[model samples]
Target: MKKKQLSIIENLIWNSAGSFTYLICQWLLTWIIVVHSKDLGNAGNLALAISITNIFFNLACFNIRPYLVSDLKQCYRSEQYSAFRLFTCLASLILCLIYTCMFGYTMDQIICVMLYMVFKLGEAWVDLLHGFEQRKMRMDIGGISLFIRGILSVLSFMAGVRFSGSVNTGIIFMTVCTWSFIFLYDMPQARKFEKIAPVFTKETIKKMLIEFLPLTIGGVLSSLGPSLPRQFLEAEQGSKVLGIYSTVATPAVFVQVAATYVFNPVLTEFASLYQRGEKRRFLKLLFKISFFLLAVSGASLVGGAVLGQWGLTFLYGKRIGAHADLFLPVIIFTCLNAMSWFLWSILIIFRELKALLVINVIGVIMCILIMFPLISKYGMQGVNDTLILYTCVLLVLMAVLVGRDIKCKFDR
Candidate 1:
């Protein structure tokens, strides 16, 4: 039986629902640690695990999903992408272990980091599968998989933590549950579209690695932009402080996630518009998306101002609520990050890989230059400030590059 293809609106709804549920579940893990365990340090440990693994997650993913979906010409086979992803995933896992050891983390932290990396590995693999479904315009299947995985993993984690009283145990449960979903649900759904046998040929693998290397490096640097601050905070102030910062910064992620949900469904459309020389319509769509991002940012700021502290208190406890000042800056940083991501998508559609790499490199350089001084002087607030600066610079540089590309190609 052939499955029906979804309209863009249906895709958006399903994707949004699935992503929102997954993100909310992820957020709740931190909340569960704080409220159930009554330990900010546990939350911090989890946060640190997440911070470290995210860099490697980017490495493994190599920002390929967007490239895959937007490959209008079908330049690469699904099997080749799968094979390449398998290689990256193994490399990321090994490198994660090396990175964790080099940082001289305690055994417990190392264990936690490894467990979380395994969990994130599951996500990375499933993300490739989602790309397959998305390329077929069946994001609904991907969304359903995400929704189910989210529910199951969170429940399993909560139960494990509740019963065992250890975050690592919960993560183990989460990891197991996630991979189960991948084997049972996601793989099946993706196989409906095509056979996902991994194909490894030297020529194809080398070509893919060479072509996507810039995006891979940019992804690592971009991940570092936000992560360096958390890493610094953990080194200087310890896990409790990082926990508070991670908790306070959690809500702001919705801005970026929401922005992604808005733009991702229309990415193919944007490509189509540009490829067809529909310049006016492309610009109009771009402006609409920008306006929507701005509106969402404003709403987030207002909400942060009005209910940020109280809400943090209500959710995670007063320890986190006390850092309400971080809320506004975090929201701004997230908004900027979201805008930068939108610009990145635009540049990707334009196939301006060098510009994308250069912009992210500059942002990362800015992060390294200012991260220490900011952290040394301002404490956690400095972390927020550093990220804001890095993302702000990225947003500006990318905007300029995107503008130049548009002028050259669209404006005539």
Candidate 2:
């Protein structure tokens, strides 16, 4: 069998397209719901729900996909990785359910949140398959699955909400779309690389979990750091303002997704370089990537400043567009946050899990302490300001830690 291969440009296109498609669909779906229902509050609630669910999903993921993808030693079989992902997905669902129930939401909110969980779970399963695809250099499969899933899920969501006038119904349709794609597309493609079966050795699972614990904790905190603003807005100003804030801030996600997709295909090469003592080449490539991310951030901020309001109105609706001015600063920090994420990836490449944990913990704590006060004083704009401050501090800390680690490891 010929091994699948793609150049950097090809990898960038497929991965970025797929990710962009999903995010656009999600953003569009939120817009559609908000517009059609004439209920900004519901939109905000959904945003908060999805945001919290994403935190859980990231926690469940524990940054394992990349850890699995970068397994140059082939220490574990595909089945074992798959089993861990499945276990985490189940655990995430269980924990999310418990948290939701304990908070005591209305019946509608509970149903909507649970359905979103189902949708996210299915997406998580596909992401595990993507790790296999990425390892095999078959990112085309990952691209195709994400693109198709995004299209179908959003379309189903639109149809459900448009016809039935219910967000819960729309979410259910989205879940169905995920399951259909997972079984029909992702699972079969994954099997072509290796068999798909659960492997549960107690000791092996425990060891893998322990090894990945720091990264996992870091992933959760990293997600929570940004989520603090949305959670606060939802609590303090109510869902309508949150909805507007969410929509205005949503487009910035593209910058982060693009950076990740662009960098992903080269991760294996970084690991190989490190393994072969090509420290100079590794560090050179790392700096180049970081510089590219900075360029991307700069471009995004300029673009947002120019087209922020218009773009928001075009994608969402006029109601949401009123807050579009917030896009500029929000996107600036988003780019910074994206760069910080890239730096964390460097730490992961070096397996510096403790540093990753420390960086993210401090970031989250800073965000929390300042978030409430800012949101209270400045309203929606304050949330954006708080994020910018948090990301700046976080980015500096990560850059310093990662740079020191590289020097210690490769300075000769």
| Candidate 1 per-residue lDDT over residues 249-347, each given as its tens digit | 988898889889989888887888888889999999999999999999999889989998898888877777888899999999998999988998888
lDDT of 2 by residue, 1-412 (tens): 7565777667768887888887778777777777677778788768878887988889667687767778878888888887888888888888888877876567787777878988888877888888877877778778887888888988899888877888888888888877987898788878888767888888888988899888998898888888878877877878788888887877788887788877787887787887788988988888888889889988888888888888888877677777887888888878887888777777788888888888889888899999988989999898888999999988898878877877787765
Candidate of highest TM-score: 1
Candidate 2, lDDT over the whole model: 0.82
**Alpha-carbon runs more than 4 Å astray in model 1:** none
Model 1 C-alpha RMSD vs. true structure (Å) is: 1.2
